[model samples]
Target: MNREKLMKMAGAVRTGGKGSMRRKKKAVHKTTTTDDKRLQSTLKRIGVNAIPAIEEVNIFKDDIVIQFLNPKVQASIAANTWVVSGSPQTKKLQDLLPGIINQLGPDNLDNLRRLAEQFQKQAPGEVATQEDDDEVPELVAGETFEAAANEAPSS
Candidate 1:
């Protein structure tokens, strides 16, 4: 070995015989359940006062109800269908909506539009023609969706 190679090998032995460089990382932690709770509440608002039709069924293995404004359109969550009617016949939204677009034979576009139009008539100004920012408000600090929902008086 040359003089320079001998000196380099000797230096490596003096420093624990390691051959690679690395960086050290610091650990970090966060606590932000507040934002998640806020978003869930906002989705739970909106309207169902004048829905066109509603379907009641067991979904996700739970006795839930799915309200329909049109064939596949829903205005309220499944479990809250009773909010509109005290006693609705057991039915499924799947019973009305075609399983596939092809099943309609590509000739139900007008029927679909008419269904939507009828829904609009039932609930004027309730459709998506305007934004619903005013309908859902932001949650205050230290507040949860369940707490806010429980506090609201049932209509």
Candidate 2:
């Protein structure tokens, strides 16, 4: 009857049933605040103590890329990049999110300060206020607060 049917009849292809043979569609995801929390949790679980991306929450098209500085298991400081498709206010990227998050390392104070700088970009209609965090943060992978602080620029 049709090209696919002909192939199937010839045993050149494997059909699921006697009826339709089209593949099932994948589920589409919609981004949510829970997704953000999940992402944060995943990063935390993977030993990625600090996400160094302090840049504006820039979302263009359907992609979000964040870079954080963390110490590797080998005791070295490096920049880690995470590329996420979609946003809490935009699209949802579900399928690949979990696998991407599993690859995380550690954090530092300089990384946090750099990250904190980005909070200045207020969302539309959001009131701005300053609340300082003088306390040192919890360091992962045995990294010290002083080590992270040394990476920050003296104010």
Model 2's alpha-carbon lDDT is: 0.49
In terms of lDDT, the best-performing candidate is: 1
List, residue by residue over 1-155, the lDDT tens digit for candidate 1. Answer: 79999978667555344564433355776658877666446545643344445443222222233432223223455446423323334445446455423445445766766656756665655554335535664565899989999999999
lDDT of residue 78 for candidate 2: 38
Query: How many angstroms is residue 118 displaced in model 1 relative to the true structure, after the best TM-score fit?
Result: 1.1
Clashing pairs in 2: 47-105, 52-68
Give the per-residue lDDT of model 2 (tens digit) for 33-69.
8888996676655545433444323233433433222
Candidate 1 wrongly placed segments (more than 4 Å): 1-91, 94-100, 124-155
Q: How displaced is residue 21 in candidate 1, in Å?
A: 99
Can you tell me which runs of candidate 2 are displaced by over 4 Å? Answer: 1-31, 51-155
Quantify all predictions' global Cα lDDT against the true fold. Answer: 0.51, 0.49
TM-score list, all predictions:
0.18, 0.17
